[model samples]
Target: MTASVILAPLVPVVVLWVLAGLAVAFVALALWRGLAGWWLRGLTACALLAALANPSLQEEERAPLSDIVLLVVDESSSQRLGDRAAQTAEAVAAIEAKVAGMENTELRVVRFGDGPEDAGSLAMTALAEALSEEPRARVAGAILISDGQVHDMGLVPALPAPLHLLMTGREADWDRRLVVKNAPAFAILGEEVTLTLRIEDQGAAPGAEEADLTITVDGGAPQTYRVPVGQDLDLPVVLPHGGMNVLQFATPAVEGELTERNNAAVVQMNGVRDRLRVLLVSGEPHAGERVWRNLLKSDASVDLVHFTILRPPEKQDGIPVTELSLIAFPTRELFVEKIEEFDLIIFDRYRMRGILPMSYLENVANYVSNGGTVLVAAGPEFGAVDSLWRSPLAEVLPVEPTARVIERAFVPELTDLGRRHPVTEGLEALAPEGGWGRWFRQVEVSPRAGQVVMQGADGRPLLVLDRVGEGRVAVLASDHAWLWGRGFEGGGPQLELLRRLAHWMLKEPELEEEALTATARGQALTITRRTVAEGPPGDVTVTGPDGAEVVLPMPEAGPGKFETVWQAPVVGLYRLEQGDLVRVVAVGPSAPREFEATIATGEVMAEAVAATNGGVLRVEEGAPDIRLVREGRPAAGRGWIGITPRGAYVTEDVSVAPVLPAWAWLLLAAALAVAAWLLEGRRGGRRVSGTA
Candidate 1:
């Protein structure tokens, strides 16, 4: 119970002053007229003023609110490593018990897990939010239970009390992590890309022996190399083909210590072409020569070198020598010497014109067999007696000309297999009103053992793809494709179709017949397996960096395309496999922010807590018991902790009663004046008589 004096004005203070002025005037009049009452009038005015002030005693009942203690727990991925989980659980239980026994104190526990959007533990952010919801008067102190690895320190709120930390880790904790500091997202196929990498040792000696590193591409045989410790190294790697190249780099594990799951890193580089060098050889100068030149010249990446036999040896024109404007064609310089310099060779309506000898034709076949691409855009001459099939290059071509020309208006259609091929799939948008276009002419050709991708009029082979030794070959049996560009029967995707076909023949990885791909977006792994033949669903085994294996079942995403998604439990290199196919992808950082440096240091949280007059306490010795300490006194003792007690009070009612009535005050003033006048008059008479 509490008591205090409060004043409620019964009458306005100005009115009380007016009443006192009237009383003073009456006393002065009585004294001047030989009536004595000055002292009595002053006494009456004092009593009247006191009564109008309306003084009353106020009482209140209040109980002090308990001091609040905030407990912040770190539940990030790093806390789950090794014995740290058990240690955190035990510490949390002990903290709850200690907080329960304290008098005039309450505990508020806030648990923080891995942050959304890949931010690490948001302990400081959580603490700041909790502080904003509660009153500062009731909060006495704050305690944090973490591994001392906080990501959002700038979010620390303004605290009115002391804060402390109970770190969770051993003094001898050490870790080593593989770091790929800089890596390119895309690299040209067959070209070396320099990758900057570093191997860092945390809480370990720098002079330790260098570690052995192994690098593997697409899960092939790993190439072992030795890398020195605590230094950045530039590694030159050549991309195999166009598409996603999964490269895994790992360091040898150590003995009798922390886990080695984070000792490796995986990088994915999308392969591209630095330049497309094409050699277009034409037998004679015709209208199709400009078409081939325009198509190849449209792409900025394509380096086109076109040659045409403007004058055949048999064409005898009776004219002076060197009189014609045409220059001599250099067949030997192109096909015999610098043939390897070009990535692809295109025969556009070329025949046995005798300009390229039989030896030069054999050299072109050898070029295709030695990892070079070739495309034969056949014309009516393909069925002539001098067809290319009669030359040494016939072995590399996928189809054989049947000496028959099919000239009819028919629409080009995708085969059942072509509907699933990346080159022809999803190409309906290229046609007008989403309908296939019609071709004016197509050669009659019989497909060999290779795959038939497109069928034309009368169900003849329109396009064929086959492998020749280590290279790829393709045949487009129509020279009227340019007619589509001229909007014949509603133009189609002439450029896109031609581009995809040319790129596929160059052995781009994304267009491979059999492929295994994995893409990571945040914590989800989207795995795609593409193949031509239908078989059992491939086994997708994702091996996390911690050596944990999770086998996923892949369902069909599309025709001949199988897909599955796995929510990754931790960040690291995830190995995917299906039969002989294998791929590696990085889910998150190989070393998580928490485990990046396992040593428990209070460096990050120290400044934040210090702003609130807090200190860091190592839990190795034991946590102190929390207690309420008075203000301006020591907050902690030898074995116990102290918290400041906060006293709070709220009003129940505010109504106040008047101390006196207005009529009573007026009557009392009159009575006191009359009595004082009579008494003073008698005293004056007695004094006069005594003096006489």
Candidate 2:
């Protein structure tokens, strides 16, 4: 309990001062006039003033509160490198013990890891939140144990006490990282695209002047090149095919490097064709000839070359050849000279004609065998004596004509295999309830090789796709496809089906018959396996950046797609393999923010620490001793960090009592006035006796 004097004046403070001034004036006047009772008058004035001025004594019950010390521990990915994790653990324990021994102080610990969505270390954010939970008045100081690679510096709070840092990491630590300065999202296929890259050595990399750079595309074989470190490199690359291409660039990690996580980087660039060159050869005027022509003409990217054989060499009409108004077809130039330049070659109702020699036809077959594409749209001629099946091109054709044509109306339908094939996977869903439009005729054919994706007229092969040595071949055994385009009976997916078929032939990655793909959001990895093979495609084996492998079972999500979502343990590159297929995906980044700079320093937190009058010390040197200091004084020194003692307490009960009551004061003043009167009478009586 504590007691102190507090004023409880009967009148206002200003009124009490006025009354005291008047009493002093009256005493002075009586003394100056030579009054007999002057001394008594002075005593009476003092008593009256004291009675009017009231005072009280205040007492309180108090309880002292303990000072709070905040400890923020960094558990982010960067701290896990080398011996930093061990260092952080040791520092935390030492701090806890030191605070436990300090008098009237408590410790509050806050531990944090990698921030959400690869935001890196958020030590400042964690510190601010922990400070808000406790009383600012009770907080003595805050200490952070980290590598000091803070990513959220903007969140530093206005600390009420000093802030100290126990930095983790060695001075000799160094790292080699691959940096991609510029990479385009899309590049033209078969054209050289320039990519800017740099190889950097951070921290104490001694005598590192040169390094070997390894580059790989789509998980293929790697190529090595000797490049200068600390310099920008312009690499020229040509994509082998059209679609999404994954390019991986890496440099060898040195012996003393902090981590190999940033030694490699991955870039995904989409390959697109500048222009699609197509050669369309029509045997004669046919109903479906316009369908292929119109479709190819509508696309701005397609370069269409069309020719029609209106008159065969054997046609003996009685007219001069000059007046025939017919220009000789450049078969040699198109078939022999520039065949490879064309992306796709289409034959509309075409048959083996004497115009193109057997040698030229052989060249066409050779073209398909050597990385070229051929699409056959057959008519009744396919079943005739001059059918292409009877020529040199028959080797690449997916179907063999049976010399028969069915002239009955039937709707085209997807075969069991077609339902799983990427080209025709969802075509059936676009059809009406009554199915697709009817085709009046279809040539009878048997699948000699390759997949029978579509069928009609008693399950006869209608559409078949095959892959030659390094090329692709597709056969559509009818000339009535235009019927669907014309809305003959509610047009089917004429546009979508043909588009998918064309893109598939062009080697679009999304339309591959068998493929493995992955996409990442945050640390969750979505793996998708697309195939037409029977049964489950089996579980996928995932390999992380740390070379740790995990086998995850992929459940069937669709007709031919197997998928699963697995949470990645950390950020970095991940390789997925199921059978012979391989796919690589970066979970958060090829180089996570934490590993971007592994050699830790306290420079990032220096300004904030200085503002709070705190010290920054290295954990390798030894944990500093914790001490208590007065507020507003320096709280850190060479070998010790300090917290301020805030003399904080809570008042339980307050009591206020007047020193003297108002009525008692009034009675005492009246008594003093009567005594003064009696003294003055006695002195006057004595003076009267002397005068007598």
Candidate 3:
């Protein structure tokens, strides 16, 4: 119980002050005048003012509140290095023992590891939250057990008491990290892009002024380079293809460095092509010839070279070749000299007419075997004696044309493989039921180890696609496909079909029929499997950031897409593989923030700790002795950390009563006034008697 005097004034405090001032002035005036009843008047005024002031005795029933200390443990990736983990355990044990033994003290333990987004060493954030949940008056102190590499120092809370840091790493610890200072998110293919990188030494790196770094692209073979440390290195890289390119740069691990995780950095750059060069060879000027020309020329990124064989060399005309407005085709330059310059070559109803020599055709075949792409759009002439099937290019063709042409209106349909193929998977959706236009002709053909993506004229292979050596070949056996371009029977997806077909042949990563792709968003992996099959594919094999592998079954997402979202238990690189496909995805930071500053120091928390009049001591130097200190005093010594005693209390109940009642004060004042009057009269009468 605590007792204190409190005022309960009948009027405002200002009124009381006014009355008291008046009484003081009257007393002073009476004293100056030497009045006989001055003492009696002063006593009556004091009594009246006391009754108006209403002073009371306030007694409070109090219970002592226990002081709370927050103990935070850091388990970020950096904490896993060297003896830091063990050192942290020891510190935690000692703190718990000391706090537990203290009288009327409670330990509120809060452990924060790597955050979901890989935000490193969130000691301050966790401390702020813990402080908010408890009463500020009761929070005696906070003790953080970490490496002191805090990423969110801005969250350092307004501590009501001292905030001490028990740092985890030794002063001699050191680390070396590779930093990609600048890199473009998108790089054009066939153009060299410059990437700025730096090799940095944190704490105590070895005395080597230069370091050797191994750089690899797309998990390919590594190339080593000796580079100067402590400075930026500009690396020029040219993309091999148009797709997501993974570039991994790593430095050799030192004997006593903190960790190699930061020694390596992964950067993903998307590769895009500047232009697509296409060569279109038309046998004759036909209605469908404009379709091929329009498709390739319409794209701003494509460079189109087109030629039409107006007349064969054996044919004679009345006018001279120059006067007849006929230009000789440049077969030698296109086929023999700069054949590899074009990304793709298209042949539209080109029958072997002795125009291109057998040697040129052989060169074309050789080109396909050496990473070239070819597309054959055949008409009825493909089944004739002079068909390209008899040329040297026949060896690279996916199908051999039979000497039969089916002439009947038939709707183009996707084969079982086509329905699952990336090119035609959802083509049917664009054309409603019976919405697709019909083709009037198709050249029958027999496939030789080629995928039939489309069929026409009684289920014969209308479209065949295959890989020849290191290159690709695609064939469309029907020439009436352009009939749909004319809106024949309410036009089909004529442009869409040809566009996807060309892109797929060009080996676009997105158009790969069978592929595995994984995308990461905040440590979660969205794995997608794209294949040309009806039912579900097999379970996808996932290689985690660690080399451990696990198989996950894929679920059907769309017509030919299979996907699953997986939350990774940790942050790192994940490799996903299914069949012949593989993909690498990075979760969170490529170099986790914890490992960024591995050589632990108390520098990060020093300011905050000092702000609360606390200490920043390393655990390696031995746990500091805990002591109690007064508020506003320095709570840290060379070998000791202090906690302030809050002396907080909770009021169980309160009672108040007036020290002196109004009636009592009034009665005492009346008696004093009567006595004063009699005393003054007696003194004056005595004087009168004496004078008489």
- Tens-digit lDDT track for model 3 on 252-333? 9888988888888888889987788899999888889999988888889999999998887667767766677656799999
Per-residue lDDT value at 88 in model 1? 77
RMSD of each: 5.9, 7.0, 5.2
TM-score of each: 0.82, 0.79, 0.81
Worst 10 residues of 2 by lDDT: 683-692
* Candidate number achieving the greatest lDDT relative to the actual structure: 2
* lDDT score of residue 293 within candidate 2: 86
Off by over 4 Å in 1: 1-63, 204-207, 282-295, 308-330, 428-431, 534-554, 567-571, 627-642, 649-692
Number of backbone collisions per candidate = 4, 0, 0
Weakest 10 consecutive residues, lDDT, candidate 3? 683-692
Off by over 4 Å in 2: 1-62, 281-301, 304-336, 351-362, 384-392, 486-488, 520-527, 535-555, 563-588, 627-634, 654-692
**Residue 43 C-alpha lDDT in model 2:** 72
Ranking by TM-score: 1, 3, 2
Clashing pairs in 3: none
How do the candidates rank by lDDT, highest first? 2, 3, 1
Over 10-99, each residue of candidate 1 has an lDDT whose tens digit, in order, gives: 788788779778868876765566545666767777767767776767766655577788888888877776677777778778888987
